[model samples]
Target: MTNRKIVSPSDMAFSYMGRIDFSKPDSPLFIYAGSMVSTKFTGTSVGMMIFPHLIYKVTWIGVIVDGIQYKFDLNHSDTPVYIPIIDGLDEGEHTVTIYKRTAGSHHYFNFCGLMIDENAEVRPENHEYDMNIEVYGDSVSSGEVVEAVNYCEHTDPAHISQFDNSWFAYSLQLARKLNARINCNAQGGISLINGAGYFDNYIGMETVYKQMGYEPHFELTEWDFSRYTPDYVIIALGQNDANPDPKRIYEKEYREKWKSVYKNMVLDLNEKYGGKARFIVITTVLMHEPTWDDALDEIVNELAMDNVKRFKFRRNGAATPGHPRIPEQTEMADELFGFITGWES
Candidate 1:
């Protein structure tokens, strides 16, 4: 089936479900990578930090994996987008096709790109281990809002490309400081399971942990991670699932289910890597709800056993409107870096 045109938020949420197969060598899937920022239109609402409409241009890009043309959400005025991959196609050749269109009014930022290895391995042979790092999580992990895209209204077009060779993004910035290559697979607004949480919500730690082994449904070639291993795997999920909606409140049973999901996800990772890899879990900084934060703290405490460690992050003052901004991202990276290099002394 031809890919449907996605216009609404709900449609964007489940758009990954519709795709063609591109795993065969002859067939390649297309995906929308990178991001375009939008300037504040006269009547539009102010965008979120990760999706600020003032400093960035309105851009659209994509790539194909396995035969499916996976698209990114460019009209991210409300929340972030999560592009799903197949069950196990991480060991092959893949190509990405981008449709970059930027307006003259705003500077832009690219959403985190899809990262992969030859076959799901962490570090590849002869590949620099210290030079490679894999980041997994939601928008915050991908460097959501670096500037206001709409500030350039009615101005000359900004000289911005999605891959403008910059690392203002906290994840990429952190990678750069370490002199490591970044495999940033963090999507915006992703949940623990495929479709288990609300949009713009905190995705649980378990969900991201399970993402490392996922295969794209339409891969043009095989890609595997077995050949590549990162010295560190940073996980910055769990803000999107903290909402107190009537249907998703954390009751006793719900809490148990959440704990189970978190436990199993970590266990699976340990089993896959045989406890050789280090896992870091981070709490939400933009999260304002007390109940939600408390519950997450408890869950993090539970997941803190064995080889997994928990990193407590406070809300950064640089939140634009409501969500965390670039300042928060920088702070978060600083926190993680301290944990990494013993710089606290």
Candidate 2:
């Protein structure tokens, strides 16, 4: 018989890569796209103890070993269990990174712990994040429909769990390009204000930003700003603000209220970063109303803070009617990366 070693959430051998709730350090909660847990093992097998989603049966996770990548579903129909990710690796030390490719919109499970062969040696990751970046946006930033490659430049496949993969998200891609730790706070239909967006019940990023993506599907704690403040906060709202909703975009009051709230929201984020970090506000290449972008320009101007600047894409509104695919995500990442590094294309 083989002995088993349980790695609790608080185990030093585990390294967290995103804004995971650590109240129960031994079994932390994961929210948002790109949230991850990483570690290395000396044996051929390792597995995850997960509390699966009750409603959505399709939960996708990106499991990377050394340089190879694989995907798995974590949504179990019953109680939490030890789900083996990869059990047949070479019998030697191996590094593994497991991240949520689907967001709270798709899965709402918190990992319980990790199981490894008792004789195996395990250790935390060695990579150091010289910089930290936080992103707040809607479906585009959440990697929704990114794998719907067949519909590029047109429209997304009807929102399906199979199509969403945060690994291909521009925010995560940008993090990889810049070699930074990221807190990607994104949802599928969130907008800047509380009452406008593709999401039902007016669930906006403004409300979700302060919490750990709390929804009826799961339990989460209020975000402790002291935990993971960033050097830069990237805001990607406004794309869905013009969606047919509780707010009428054509009205002057609607535009005025939007700009006001938008400015205040940035100010709130600036304060969260201790008023020293910068805010790079932007919209995506996904086709949208000129009014939303126009209002953003006004908001950035009104803020008048040197650290808060709006970065525009060369092909912003000229890209596609559907959610951006992997190619467009890379294109956007290139432009944003260039802007951040102060490099001219």
lDDT of each: 0.42, 0.81
| Count of clashes, each model | 84, 3
Please tell me which predicted candidate would have the highest TM-score against the true structure. Answer: 2
In the range 118-237, model 2's lDDT, one tens digit per residue, is 888788778888678899988899898898888889977676678888888999999999998999999888888887787657778778888865564665468888888787789999
Stretches > 4 Å off in candidate 1: 1-131, 149-166, 193-195, 199-223, 243-249, 303-306, 314-321, 343-345
In model 2, the runs with Cα more than 4 Å from the true position are 245-247, 343-345
Model 1: number of backbone collisions: 84
What tens-digit string does per-residue lDDT give for candidate 1 at 183-204?
A: 5655555555434444332334
Give residue 263's error in model 2 in angstroms: 1.0
In angstroms, how far off is 113's CA in candidate 2? 1.7
